[model samples]
Target: MSALTGTTRLARLVLRRDRIRLAIWILGTPLLGYALAGSVASIYPGQEARLGYATTSASSLVARAFNGPIHGTDLGAVVVAETYVTLALIVALLSTFAVTRHTRQNEETGRAELLGANVVGRYAPLTAALLVIVAANTLAAVLLAVALAGAGLPLAGSVAAAAAIGGVGVAFTAIAAVTAQLSVTARGANALAAATVGLAFVLRAAGDVLGEQSADGTRVRSAWPSWISPLGWGNQVRAFDGERWWVLALPVALLLVGVALAYALAERRDQGAGLIAPRRGPATAAPRLLSPAGLAWRMQRGTLLGWAVGVAVLGFSMGIAGDEFNDMIDANPAAAEAINAMGGGADLINAYLAAMLGLFALTIGAYVVQALLRVRGDEADGVLEAALATAVSRTRWLGTQVLAATLGAVALLLVAGVTTGLGYGIVTGDPLGQAVELGGAALLRLPALLVIAGVVTAIFGLLPRWSVVLSWTALLVFLLLGQLGAVLELPQAALNVSPYTHVPAVPAVDPAALPLVVLAAVAAALLAVGVAAFRHRDVPS
Candidate 1:
């Protein structure tokens, strides 16, 4: 058979395997973008209102850093600026992780070896994975365009915005492919790809914030800094301003160049090996690696640290912008109402801080779930079997992962609270009190987060194959309910299904102690049942 033979067939197989996953990625992201755009347009209906909001947002460095640079005063531009950067970040990260996992990860685990032995081409797996990502991202772009245009945005701008998002995904997919060839393991590839995107975001944010300030009292309007980042290039397309379509060429060129480089590297590397070979560690395992708990910590510590740093930075930046909301509330009554709904308080800064903390808490919950799911990963890798061969009991093995996850959750909550409180307190002149108050507020949400982690553990015990999907699906439902339910005006009964809805807004509002206690009790019970079930079941072959 030819070296490129069966590539198209493998591509088709991959599409069939990933049909639901692709749909979720493509539909979920654009739907979110469209919803946010429509809501912003409605909230600031008039041109005057849009202009006022834009001017206010521009002054907040945190806002400018998270969102891209605001262009014109139109509602469309404001929506694009506020929403597209985030959307692109999400899409690109998802695409990269998905592609790298199915391609290089499978190869590293020997699954691709089994498949490759059956008439597959040398490069078919990588090619097929890239094709799947491209197709999914293309669908996302088309759907996003339609959704935005249908929401009353101009056709050209909407399409350009969608194309920009797709370009970002394509660029990252190629980057992931290249990293996959360089790293020996899936975790390494994921880390490198994620870090690249994160660094790009930070750079783009720094460049945008700095570029926004007047140097020597003269405003700089050049797109130079933005042009250096893929994300910035997307923003420079100026979707709602004059429709700078030529900017799309940059990401396209980068994607092509990245893919070519990846393929060339692939030809140089051997199957199941990386361009950069794994570095050998100590000849003997560390004393800490003797226990399952220590092993779990060893595996997850890097990821937790990365998340903590991101959360801390995000909290600190948002904290610095607290004072800006004071001015914003005075200028815009509608914005004030939105802030009030998030956390009912007379002090707009406190309310904003409360809302930001709540959002960060949910992210902390996601990290907790991923950490706890290391049990599933261990089971799949046959590591659990090897450990079981020793004197270690199943319960003990499971307990190690669960304990690590719980502690990691607490660590993340502390990091977020301390960072946010320190930043806000220093500016407001009440350092110690604010830190204690915010830290306590973050702690209150832990019960709900633990409850979700317990649910994942229970699913893994009872239905191993369905565990990851169900857990992730639960997260998606929570996200939609928490974010979109308010916008769609959904019933309180439906909204209350999410655990986050139960965590009372802190610092601004009085704590609801009963709900927090109940959540904790539920978490403990679920964990008990899951561990018991795991003890009774035979490990899947």
Candidate 2:
């Protein structure tokens, strides 16, 4: 059989395996764009209103960091500016997970060995994975363009924006492909890919923040910084204001170069091995390192550090953003009300800090999910069984991972809170006070986070096979509810599903004792049930 013999079959298999996942990615991006554009049109109906909003956003460094430059006062440009960065991020993430799931994850699970024993080509699995991602991006682009135009955006701009978003997804797919070849473990591969995405975001944010704009507000930013980063290229497309179509070429070029490199590296390495070999461990395993808790820590340290750095940087930068945000709220009444609602009180700065903590609390869920899911990971790899072979009881072995996840979560939350306080305090001329307030604000959301962590723990213990899926699905639901529930006009019941909704936006309002106590009780009960279930179940091979 030819080297690409089973490519078509594998492609079909991938489609079957990821049907729900693909639907989520392909549909979610365009739908969000539609929602954002429709909301922009509704909220800022008049040109003057839109222009005022744009001007306020332009002056705020925080706005510029998150959303790219605004080119025109037209509704189209407003939508593009508001949605492009966030959409690109979502698409990039979709592509990253899709590739990593099919390629690296399969190999790590030993499924690739079974497939390779058949008529499958050596490269067919990777090829099939890329093809699926490419198809998903293509469909998303078409759907996004249609959705935008259907929503009354200009046709040319709609197509340009959709295509640009697709470019991000495609480029990340190639990046993931390369990273998969380098890392022996799926987690390592995901880390490397995630790091690339993080760097791209920072580079783009830096470029937009530092770039000197010409008087016309015509030249949005310094294109040089954007030129170096693949994700940044999507924003430069200038979809509504004389499209810079040349920018899309960057990701295309990256896809080609990255794939070629991946293939070459694959050729040089043996199946089931990484391009770079892992280092030899200590001649003797340390007694301290042999415990389950120690092992969990060892597995989690890198991830903890990575997340801490990102959150700290975000907090510090947001703290500095207070000056501009204050100026912004003074000029925009709409912004002030929004901040007021989130927890900054009548003082817009405090409201901004309160909002940041809430948002940061949501982001922390990603880490919590990853940490707790180590239970499922260990089980899948038979590590749990081997560890259980010792004098360790099942509950104790599993409890170590749960404990690590909880304690690690607390540490990360404090880091985020303290950093937010420090950054906001220093910028606002009251470092100590702001730090205490914001740090408390961060801790305010702990009960909510614990509920989430407990939910994941419960899922792992009770539904070993479905744990990863159900737990992550819950996390997504909570995240969407916290971030977009109000704007989407979701039902009270839906909003109540997320524990975060119960946590008071601190500093803006006084902390309430009742909600936290109730949330804690729920989490404790769920975790206990999950642990109990795990004890009696047979371990799946």
Measured by TM-score, the strongest candidate is 1
Model 2: what TM-score? 0.94
Best by lDDT: 2
Superpose all Cα atoms of candidate 1 onto the true structure and report the RMSD in Å to 1 decimal. Answer: 2.3
Candidate 1, residue 278: how far the Cα is off, in Å? 1.6
lDDT of 2 at 396: 89
Q: TM-score for every candidate vs. truth?
A: 0.95, 0.94
Please provide, for model 1 over 1-541, each residue's C-alpha lDDT reduced to its tens digit, 9 standing for 90 to 100. Answer: 8767778988887888777778788888778888888777766778766666777766666767888777777777877876887799888888889888878898889988898889988778888888889888889999999989988998988998899899899888888989999998998899889988987787788777876533322122434666788877787787877888888888778878887898899889888899887899999999999988789889888989999999999887777677677777776776766666665567777778878887887788789778877778878888888899999999998888888988998988888887888888888998788778888888877888888888888998898867777787787788667655665567999988887778877877888889898888888998998999899998854
How many residue pairs clash (N, CA or C atoms closer than 3 angstroms) in each of the candidate models, in the order given? 0, 2
Off by over 4 Å in 2: 38-43, 150-152, 216-219
